[model samples]
Structure formats: C-alpha cells, structure tokens
Target: MSNRPSPLNDWQRHCVRRTLERGGVIAYPTEAVWGLGCDPWNEDAVMRVLALKQRPLHKGLILVAASVAQVEFLLTPLAPELRQRALAHWPGPVTCLIPDLQQQIPTWVRGRHASIAVRVSEHPVVRDLCNTAGMPLVSTSCNPAGRQPARSGWQVRRYFNDRLDWLVPGELGHERKPSRILDIRTGRRLR
Candidate 1:
C-alpha cells in the first residue's frame, strides 16, 4: 500500500488541485460510492455541484477532510469531550454533525442547518485529494438526486458525462454502504 503513489501521480494531482483552485468540481471515489467534491469555500464551485446533482441548495453538503487538523478552526471551540468525541472517529468512515458554534463554515455548506456535516475519510483517494487540496472538500454522492450512488469509475463517467472538471481514478474502499452519520451532540444516527 505504501508503494502506491498517493492515489494520483504528481501531474494528475497538480491538475486536480489547479482545477479546484479555479472553482471546478471533480468526481472521485469514496468509501462506498463515487462522490462529487469541490472547494467548500468556493460558492460558484459549490453551486455547480448542486446543479450537477440537480440538488436543492437547502439540502446542504458534507465536507470530507484528510485529517482532523484540517478542521481545527471549527473543532477548537468545542468542549473537550465533544471535540474528542468527534475526533475519535477520525481517518475513517463516520460522518459527524458538529455544531457550527464559531460559524466558520459558510452558509452554503451548512445550508439550513445549525451544524455542519463532516467526515475524516479513510479512503486513500479521498484522503489524498483532501491533503492535496490543503483543506476539506464538499462531498456528496455522485449521482442525480433520485439515482443510486456510482460505485465505479465507469458509472461516474456515465452519470456526469464529461461534466466534471476532473475524475480522480481509484477504487472504492471496502464498505457496502455510505458512512454512518451521527449527531455529535445527541449520539443520534441521522443516516
């Protein structure tokens, strides 16, 4: 596994990073499905994600990170236990709904919710993508609202059909379902 080149070759990584910096959306593999992602801070890029998915803006989005450190700006203000609670699931497939107390997350990502959905992904491609991007990327299943999430690169191409700025080539992780979402405050499962 260590011999693998962090999912993308240097040149491929560069192009993807450049595309993201320019407010472009990309499709990539996640734990159980292909995902659409863009720089969460770029409203235009985010809007394009919603448009591609034919999803409503009010539905919000998930932000996937390479590590907990990338999101310390949002996590630092929480109670230690709550902070640890969210951190404990790091570099894995659990998505936690953390309170946006500092309001650091933009409304476009938070949508109508008071909290933000975030995950520290275990999938190598996702982690590498986030690391290369130098921050979290907005993550949502790569399919139209009513369709099943794409589980293969070919499926991703069929759904987006040259629409995405880049498609990171990789395989999905060993999971049969999307990450389980939990509300950090209530320990309630949301999905």
Candidate 2:
C-alpha cells in the first residue's frame, strides 16, 4: 500500500480526479465504513455502482458532501426551524431526505421517491473528496446488500478490485455503525 497520509496528497488526488473525470466508480473512507461513490450526475457511473453492489435502482442512493452548500441545489425552500435542524446535525453521520428542487435529478439517484437523501460528511477524506470533485457524489456502503461494509482500502479492493476505477486509501472515522438516516419532513428514522 502507498504511504500517503492525506487525501490531498498529489498522487491520491490525481487518482480520484482521473477516475471521476472518466465517469468511473471509486471507494473511499467514510464515518463508519468505506463508501462507494461517483459523479451523481453520471448515469453510467451511477449504474456501475448499482451493478457492483447488485442494488436495485428503486432503493435510491445517498449523496455526501463537504458542506451543506454543496448539496443546497437539491433542497427546496425550508423553514427557519428546518434550516437550523439541518445545520445542527451536519458535518456528521446523519443522512436526511430533503425536498428535491431540481426535478432533473435522475431516478437512478432519487429512486422512486420525490426527495433525495443527502449528508454533509464529517470524515475528512469524504469531505475533501466532495470538495475536490466539486459536486456531491452518489454514496453507498462499500459492499453488496446483506453484507458487511468495508472498513479499509484493502477490504474495498478485495470486494471490488478491477470492478472499480479507484480505491482512495484512507481510514474510517470512529463509528462502529452506519450513518443514521432520517426523514426531514416527518422526523422519523428510516435506517
């Protein structure tokens, strides 16, 4: 394994940029587990992630960001309370279903639902990746459904290998479980 210490390292960033530019899937560390992601707007890239995990499109996908601003494009007009609620939990492991403003978001992303799942990640690598990519990415646990999520870059490679375009080396944050998913409108936990 390479000894690079940060996601911003030249070689690591190069790998991420190249794979994303080519509309390819990648695996990177998240708060709880490794996550598979790609340019959310790239249908081909999104399809690759779905196929790799044998995930149904109807289940939808999550978008992870460096900041709430990166995903603001997807949110509808919100009440002050709602805005504060979101702001209070962001930059952490909370995924919320917010109103989808741009009806143009592909079904492969929003699935059969009208809202889109989004999170402003606290993990440094994930945050930096979204910043570097200049857009939110389709985020999902780096494993097939019914399986445990990957926790290391090697585990990611072991699960995907040549099937993925790249595996961004990094460490998972200090969480033993996956992120909490909530319905912003209803304030209910989905997962």
CA shift at 111, candidate 1, in angstroms? 0.3
Q: lDDT of all the models against the reference?
A: 0.91, 0.85
Candidate 1 lDDT by residue in tens digits, 1-191? 12445878899899889999999999999999999999999999999999999999888999999888888888988999889889888868999999999889888889999899999987889988998999999999999989999999899989989899999888899989999999999989998
lDDT of 1: 0.91
lDDT accuracy of residue 110 in candidate 1 = 93
lDDT of 2 by residue, 77-159 (tens): 76666666667678789998876755757888989998888899878899778878888899999998778899877778788
> In model 2, which runs have C-alpha deviations exceeding 4 angstroms?
1-6
Q: Which has the greatest TM-score?
A: 1
TM-score of each: 0.96, 0.92
How many residue pairs collide in each prediction?
0, 0
